[model samples]
Target: MHLKKLTVVALSACFGLSACQKEEAPPAAPPASEAPAPARAESAPQQPVESMPPATATAPGSGSNLIREPVAAQEQPLQAIQTKMGPKESVIHLTSAKVTGQILTVEFVAVPKKRGDGRYEWLNLTLPLKNVSYIDDATAKKVSLLQDDGEAYMASPLNGTGKSIRLDGHSPITATLKFPAPPETSPTISVNFSDIGSFDGVPVSR
Candidate 1:
């Protein structure tokens, strides 16, 4: 049996547990310091590699330090669901689950209902922090996030620079997570998020 070996760090664990419910809900209007900067124009994202190093943190005012751009999230997800994250009502959209070589990349977006202030607040989607994993429908085995040789998770980091990944209260938040490829016989899996719920029958593509 494959164990759930990805240990959630204290800071990340705080975002996933109910005990930190208060922290999950951002302020009605995000503080200016917490706002995401404008995304600089860049070349289209290159194909993903088998592994990637953790993003290096820079001075607080510097922009995002994400190593690569994620695949553009689709206008429509393969599946979507509504759920509550703390006091906020949010929708989780599962966009794509594609296999490339030995890696399976899962992309999703989190859309929160506009706060009374009419602005979205930051939402943390750091995979490792949330104990995100998936179960193969065929074998009933759990698969954890892929990590590099140095043991750093290959998923996108918080805000692309922080210790954990956070979605700025820009528009909806899109996140990509990498995992080991599933069994050849399995064409779908159930993705499990810590405090968020599980999404089953999620189709897989090669």
Candidate 2:
């Protein structure tokens, strides 16, 4: 009986020690889904870059962006005068003579012969005519002006009425003539007619 009791005590002590050991052991690890995640790093903001304008190439043998200068012009010289008046001739009377710049103006009166019954006659259609004659045979080109230095100026057809006169004479007719300018220093001149004589020592006016 004593031996059976000792065996029962020893078994009770072993059971108690096994229960304490099981209680002292650590717990099992957690699942991957339940674990905490690692922290993320913070980043700085980026700046925007500025775009520049395109450059232009200059033309060959050309200047810069500044404006260019203007060029100058050329000019001509003026003409001079020498004399004004000329002598008078028969059948032709000089009424006036004047000078203005490079132009010369002369006025005169001419008396022509009466017309004959025939269609053409020497006295009727000939001699010299004026601006108001009925005959178309005479022209102002018949007259000319000469300087004291022997320089002669011819009448210009562009200055006057540019019409030729005919001699169907009833009365004296008046006419005007134009000539090129003479030298500025000429003090005396003469007027000459193709058929009539020349007049001299005529005065010059402004």
TM-score of each: 0.52, 0.33
User: Per-residue lDDT tens digits of candidate 2, residues 98-150?
Assistant: 77887566666554433566232222323332322111112223233322232
lDDT values for all models = 0.66, 0.43
Model 2 TM-score is 0.33
**lDDT tens per residue, model 1, 140-182:** 9999887667565677644443334465454687777889999
Q: State model 1's lDDT.
A: 0.66
Q: How many clashing residue pairs appear in each of the predictions shown?
A: 5, 11
Report the number of backbone clashes for model 2: 11
Weakest 10 consecutive residues of candidate 2 by summed lDDT: 131-140
Q: Pick the candidate with the highest lDDT.
A: 1
